[model samples]
Target: MLLSDLSLSRRLERAERDSNARFVEARAAVSPDVGAGWIDVGGTYAMFDGVESPCTQTFGFGLFTAPSSGDLDTIERFYAQRSAPVFHEVSPIADPAHLELLASRGYRPIEFTSVLYRSLDGDLAIAAPADSVARPFQGRVRIVDADEVERWAQTSAAGWSDVPGVGPFLVDLMRVAAVRPDARLFLAEIGGRAVAAGALTIDDGVALLAGASTIPDARHRGAQLALLSARLAYASQHGCDLAMMGALPGSGSQRNAERNGFRIAYTRTKWQLSAGTRA
Candidate 1:
């Protein structure tokens, strides 16, 4: 495979594994009044919900493609019973029919994102901020430990407030990080106060970066660079040959990934269908 394709595959693999792990963690924490189900319908799979409010269940294919009518109906039913908003994650390779299906049912197209990848096999380097921005950040980066889970979760919530399902989503993320040594959470501290946080999940030969955020007050202060530098270095030393991150369309996060050596391999869109909507 080409380097970029290899990187993308590795990234998708890491995402799938981490997502599955997150689901298991979330299921374990499900409230007594909530219910959850995992369904595999041929090529399409879904994490279904009989859950409480403020939680979302996702439906999509393991490998992006069009679903058969029967498979689509299964997906529809899975969401219908829950009465909650349902989301479908679509990659560039998603079947055109799937998009048509969602549109016909009023499942508006929401966010568009680019998947970026960087090959670590070569001499991968990231530029440091100017001395003015870099000097004050020295020795201020630290990894989030058990005691800092709540703080990290709060930081994530504040950073991703516009994203749906964030509160429960981040709580579940931190819960997994708490027990998984392979999951690294890095924070940038300024004057002994944590101001930014990011996470790295290493699986196979790929290291996927996720949940990167900096406090509004901390922007342009080298906090993000510090966290990224720390994670990349750690990944390199541990034998990872690729780094990947998802970028929201036209967002600064996308710009940062490009500036740091990651190249856009492909774009993906998230399609939504409400539970009660027609299939």
Candidate 2:
């Protein structure tokens, strides 16, 4: 469905849920240094934990999976650690009561984002590169070897200001991509210089479009479009039916997703709790 055709609220809700599920699954599978816990209150469940990153640590509560208020105190104590945690909350859990409770306990909202999704069941037509641009680079992009994987990481770091741990994170992503041949990375280049990069991962019928970025000098040069087109084409060739991405709050990434035929699926909030405070 076209992003412009959906209701903002409906789109936000859908996007957020899909994004949260993807996070829970991906992080749980690959993150070995972090801790994960699920609180079950009758039939309902809430998953909360601390995810460690280099610059900032994240404490997330998957509202849909969260147990009950009666278990909140216990869960809180369990997650309180030495490091200051950034709390994350998604929609449906951002009710007034929950907000107030967070505020009363010193939790503050930091960032918000609208999730986006695209259907891959039908043909996706992307405009061809201009005559001046290289056509060989336009075809299905894939990271088939270790050298390309390292290059992808380096290009990603260069695009994102060399954020701490990014290199390691991309390396980890490549580790997964290596075993899964169906997973691929796309780079947009001109005259043999890599200007943009993105990746497509197909898992359990879901195609996640991730790590899309363009170097500062390459912005507005159609690099994003080229990377995205390559990813969609690769996905289509591999039988993926849906494309998903988690966009940061109020960023150009969100706008770009909209322009690329992605509709807002939902909004997700991040919650932080100390690991040491749980008792």
Candidate 3:
């Protein structure tokens, strides 16, 4: 049983931070024009995928120790050098002093995420969709091979194309995710047609579950549940002890995670340097 304490925060924060670091590396490798990169400040990861990319942020701060005023200055300079806005995904369990420093730096809260976790024990359960499928079809999930990276990216992009904006950005990000080192892209199919896509990456015995999306047409099917079960099974087989993901508080994703036995580890805040203070 993992306690929701600093120890747990370290594992979860490290897992996510490393995942984004790998993503930045992958983006640079696949599309150098994007100028993707990252650096380690104190113990935090400062990543730059692009000026407008959500991957442009810092992670894992206050995990090993609190970030000093100088550390924040260095981090701000890292982003300033790239002409990008500064953002930090801060866990609630982070040292109080870190929050104080952020306040002093004129950062303001802009987003909230419910970080969730579930231990991977024996015989994991595969859930069925909340609503029965409109059409009867068998669901299957499998990890894509290297040759299918583009296919995986396309399927994942198709899943999010309906979002009001960020379609093009997500398309590129999905492409980068598909090729990240040590990352596994999974696809769910029904009647020989791919309907959903997701990604799994592990770091220090913890698995980060992300990029989950089902194409608009396949919404009522069991593709997501199948993908979730398959990813969990793979994580367990590969020696992961804990699995985690973040979702907007009170969103369908959070409810779905809760139904799958994941409990809220903490509510994290995404702090951004106020527009007036940006370099």
Better of 2 and 3 by TM-score: 3
Quote the positional error of residue 206 for candidate 2 in Å: 2.1
Is candidate 1 or 3 superior in TM-score?
Answer: 3
User: Where does the lowest 10-residue lDDT sum fall in candidate 2?
Assistant: 53-62
Model 1's lDDT to the true fold?
Answer: 0.65
lDDT of each: 0.65, 0.55, 0.88
Evaluated with TM-score, which candidate comes out highest? Answer: 3
Q: What is the TM-score of each candidate against the true structure?
A: 0.77, 0.64, 0.95
Could you give the candidate ranking by lDDT, starting with the highest? Answer: 3, 1, 2
* Whole-structure CA lDDT of model 2: 0.55
Tens-place lDDT per residue, model 3, 124-190, is: 8855547554343367899998899888888998998788886777788888898887899999998
Worst 10 residues of 3 by lDDT: 128-137
